[model samples]
Target: MATVTKPEGTIATTRKAEAEGDQLVTMRGIDWQGYLTILDMKTDRRFPRVVFLDGEVSFMSPSPTHEFLNDRLRSFLRAVLSGLGIPFLPLGSTTFRREERRGGVEGGQTYYLVNRGHVRDKKRIDLSVDPPPDLAVEIVVTHPADDTLEVYRRLRVPEVWVCTETELVFLVLDRNGHYARTDSSVALPGISAAEIHSWITRGGYDDEGAWDHDLRRWIAEVLSPRLRETTR
Candidate 1:
């Protein structure tokens, strides 16, 4: 049950879906200014995540299960990166928008690993001047109305991980400026979607200390060695 007030003079066609406490509403023909107006109005609240693409806007209210999965994935990723000793800046649910491209999105868990140095000192990210996040993660408990991947593509985000109740997908932006599915992450080097999926599933029910211990051990004894050899 999420609501958005339509901006004046915009031809808005609405579509809504609700399941398991998740709600999505898509409005077509919303101008860029209208999108900004909506975002400005909702500055105080965090729910009803919004995305805009080519005059269309989608507002999504994530369910409890959706948020639970998001937290699990974030924790798993942080552990992996920490165990690997990679310096990364995590920007949770940051809204990225490029007015020129007419695209904008709020990432579930965005990270800056390769470009961490470039933006580390900055307080805000302006997509027109700043580099896009190296990696963006999306948790899909309920499907959004717009093509969010396309929005990321337009934003030129290098890598995107899409996680669901049963699947995890890795998409790397290729030279052709399109996202292509890959097994291993280009940003995280040796980490694979399958490995992350396995960890996320296990971490959901396992004790936190036990899960962290096992994951750290695996990274130290197995993944770390593999990465070192590859670099050599």
Candidate 2:
């Protein structure tokens, strides 16, 4: 979630054991761990990824796995994005973990606290109380989405998306809580954010469905066209 999430010029303070600075502010808010147990759902494999404010939860599953793969494909993406100028944050956790998980950790449904989310309306709501992850992308290995999607609605996020490794995608939460079959990225243009995501799927690779620079090329090329079209 912290792919340098904060803009460079925002804050220069640091959090450390024996370090002190003018911007140093101890977290005095919600019981993060206590609220970890909130993601409750009926799934044979229910893994609750606790949503937290620190970079800790993001460094783990869902976020971690996505980060790891993003890292794996970054080199290819960086060149393409740089050439095409596609800017974006890798994205972070969800709200359902806080309201549903109930401390049960499994299924890789990890959650990271977002900094801002859309509780209602187009306004960006920031709960200065709990750490908030702007958005959380959950991967469903296998399961239905009725209740799972509802969890996002309750949290009031501007957007929520779930990708099934490859096949189905649910972008159920819009800025105002409008669910839809097709979804676009807050950073990229297009009705379907498929170009970039292709790199995350099996199609993102060499002949054997393995990931390689080849898939990266396809992403760069495809994104280049999309960006040019949208930027124009």
Q: Which one is best on lDDT?
A: 1
- Runs in model 1 deviating more than 4 A are 1-10, 43-45, 203-206
| lDDT, candidate 2, 132-173, per-residue tens | 334445454433344445544555444455655454353545
Whole-model lDDT per candidate: 0.83, 0.40
lDDT tens string, model 1, 1-232? 2244455776679898867667898889787777888888885567788889988888888888788778778887888788888889998888899989989987778999988888887888998889999999988876752378899999999999998888899899999999999988887777777778888777454466777778788888999899999999
Winning model by TM-score: 1
Candidate 2 clashes: the total is 18
TM-score of each: 0.88, 0.45
Q: Note the residue pairs that clash in candidate 1.
A: none
TM match of model 1 to true structure: 0.88
Task: Report RMSD for candidate 2.
Answer: 14.9
